[model samples]
Target: MTRVEINFDGIVGPSHNYSGLSLGNIASTTNKGMVAYPRAAALEGVAKMRHNLALGLPQGILLPHPRPNRDWLDALGTRPDDVPETLRPAAFSASAMWAANAATVSPAPDTGDGRCHITVANLRTMPHRSHEWPATLRQLELAFADTRHFAVHPPVPPAFGDEGAANHMRLAAGHDAPGVEIFVYGLRGGAFPARQHVEASRAVARLNRLDPDRTLFVAQSEAAIAAGAFHNDVVAVANGHVLFAHEQAFEDRPAFYAALKRLLPELEIVEVPASVVSLEDAIRSYLFNAQLVTLPDGTMALIVPGEARETPSVWAWLEAMAAGNGPIRRLGVVDVRQSMANGGGPACLRLRVVADPATVDPRFLVDESKLDRIADCIASEWPEQIAPPDLGDPALWARIEQARRALHALLELDALL
Candidate 1:
């Protein structure tokens, strides 16, 4: 049984814009209402995926939800003509481009029934994003419809406010070995609301039937979230058995890892102390958000956004970490400034699934040929730039529609049509 983990990255949509929809995210607030280049954004995202493939990493693609989601607008009891003029732009949001929020997946190795379970998130914390689950569920059901191998579960009830994989992480001895599952949540986290409810994290574990003894629940630092760590991924990320994080990321950092080590003695804890780099620097440079990928040769590489290079402290730390006798021996930096400006880093654009590629729906996978077709479509039809005011232009809707149709044609995903 060959075990593999695939990263299904979300394509930056044609409707990409900076509406400042997310409240607690610093980059979203800072670059709100600015002009966004959708073509360049999507191309950069494709290039990142291509880079991963060149490194012998497994990669997949998830399409963005159709824009101007009339289904969502209709669900709220408002027709296009009668909807409030001020709120119309919400219908065209491209927030689904951030794939990490799509769902939290538990692989077959840890489940009692031996079937992977995917809990689609009900992003209830923000009104702008709350309407997404209904549509997100439709896609999840389509992509993972094989009940024998996959069990796609509905979201935890709306009141709990689940944000999916961004708030959850799994660490195992091997891809197939049943190891520890870590659920990180925040409570009364300063001015910004804690997006991941503790109950939601517990519910996902319960839904998947994970072993309680191996599961660890930890609280995210109130200070971290207030300092712009809106989600755990903003301050920490996990890959395989290694946990890379900041010193102030957790409330009691030592205890969290100690308990994890008790469960799996090989658990590697890499913490960047605040004395070395401030929390503000971590958030600004998105140092903690780097994608920690284990390549084919078994050595690890840190895939980071170019912003990291500009920060002297972060750049020096990464250089030393890669050059020294550490698990991460390489650093791959690429430009994704378009997504970065909108509060998404390299990790934000990808969703990780642990399973054999043969078990997943073939429609959801990607290759070099498909990447070229998607990039060609983006270059030919995607709008060069989108401003906040442009969201209201009726002409913009037609271009968006055409762009999506072209992509759907290339990916052979007719479910959207």
Candidate 2:
């Protein structure tokens, strides 16, 4: 079975601060308009995409909660009407929710199919005092309960002097350790320098620790320049292979290229221009979540900047992926305008469990119109159920079955596009 894995940390909003400057960081603001906004709309888009895939194959999904503070409450507004009623309470006090279930191993309820796992950790922003360690450990335990093997690790604390701690830990753990890799960057309450080289070195160290034989290290040119150790640390660690963004080349392509050549003469440097689609901006501010999904045909899909945009910006990352020779046959651009108006994008709203291609009948892609018809039938049979009066009904269930059949027929179609 093909497995789809994702990280679910906090929610992203359109603007950084609704309360005051003291309430959030600059990245929070950027995420609001770009990552968070689009993700809200794209949640359904992702679900639909998954539904489409399920029609033809067997798939599994992995979900991880990066940390707290970026919780739903922080992303969505505090007002009752600001969030869907079902989510309002959870949004208000998600930390309490985490604490209450600290003893439980799985952060999210099991889906019964034994294909999903939710890792929960105490909000990373919280003080890592002795008192907090137990809860943190409990959260980790919950996150890895059902799975035979999983990844675990701490993030580089922003307050720490080093920036690349998280990346370093991830790389050092190597892919062989079935358990979650814990990353410990610095001491508690210490201030870390934000230099890029320091961060890059940490990343290199981690990479060296993890998959030393098969790992490749890539970074944006701008990020490399900012750190000043681009050649010595990043290139040296990966043995000559590096990925650079186009804008980085534009600013000082000659110098950047020269540096790579001198450090690792035979290095295979992949250049991704700024003009090409990318989610660098989104990722910086913790707005969008990007995942690399491989299809049954061996093509890859990069789903990022998950939002609903009138233009094609949401799927811009695909261009970059294509340039890198990623195997992506179809692009699922999520439309999360409604969700964004409130808050979030595809990455924010729904957690991705599985995104690999399925092995069912090739007919699933039959006709877009037929799929639409099936959607309509499903909608009619299962009208949006909200509140007590809108619970599931037998009639609705029957209609859902009929819609499912229609969906199956469409799935059976060979030329769906």
Candidate 3:
């Protein structure tokens, strides 16, 4: 019954490539059509998991969804060979590696039934990701199959467009305590489509049976959305009682802050002003995309992508914050440039689930040995690199399938297939 926050990261798939599938994500678009290093990318993902373990945090992993997703392509009445050039990337998208979009979780402490509830996200916005729910749901059911302690639900009707935890935040004095669950939704983002709809947020809150009094639905800033902050996590992240964010992250910051303060009296708001770090700069550097975590020693740390350090203003502000007597006591920089280039950073690469480790499937959890095994698989089987054109090559498709199968056998998770 000891509930703790576990970061479940998605292992980068063998088909990791830069097809530029995500529209609103600036990094993904900027690097579209560029060559991608699948081997190095998967290894980077595993290394990030190792880094989390070294910090004394429990780390879990979700296996990569099968690539060249034959089933989905077959359903389209066209094979990978005959599929339109525009839709080819959808068959081999590695976007599922950003586990933040996996699901919306409500821990037992905050739910009426006293069991953690997880609802898979139906990523209906983009064609490449819309088909991910079935595979993602399979993994969720397998990982949280212990019905005595967990309740797993399928995605809400895709009509509502829910992007999952990337648009959600929970705050409380401690992990086990009942907290305020804030769901950030968007109405419009100018040229970019707002992925999380208000109705979808409401559906998830109700499905989890969260207390009406403790939940709040906030709007993401249209400005942030237009500036390539596709999800709210791109501009904000919450850990325990602290809400670390950019000043322009929300549509109505003052009202949201007032409401949050009322719910959690000790709430600390660490807002980086626009004068210091503009929204463009924040999105470009992925400064707010960092993981805000509580270390075993009870001190808070920000696990940021190496790009944050490269941005002069971001690094300076972070240094000043860590140097001061702030709630965030340390900075842990990690190199996930491969993921960063594809619009995912430390936070994007993880799904935060608060649950007892004993309740989760053992196969999904990892240690040093397991990480070593995963890294070995990636090094051996994953392709050295993938250009946009390589996705259509039958040989590369076969290799990708072989790599995933090797991992399935290695982890004894073939049932997930």
Instruction: Encode model 2's per-residue lDDT on 145-205: one tens digit a residue.
Output: 3344333333333432222212221111111112122122211111312232334334433
Clashes of each: 0, 55, 0
Of the candidates numbered 2 and 3, which has the greater TM-score value?
A: 3
**Global lDDT scores for all candidate models:** 0.86, 0.30, 0.93
In angstroms, how far off is 181's CA in candidate 3? 0.2
Q: What is the lDDT of residue 277 in candidate 1?
A: 80
Off by over 4 Å in 2: 1-140, 146-148, 151-271, 275-289, 304-326, 337-417
Residue-level error in angstroms, candidate 3, position 308: 0.2
Off by over 4 Å in 1: none
- Could you tell me the lDDT of residue 154 within candidate 2? 39
> Could you tell me how far off, in angstroms, the CA of residue 389 lies in candidate 3 after the best superposition?
0.6
Candidate 2 displacement at residue 116 in angstroms: 15
lDDT per residue as tens, model 1, 369-414? 8888889999998999999888778788889988998888877777
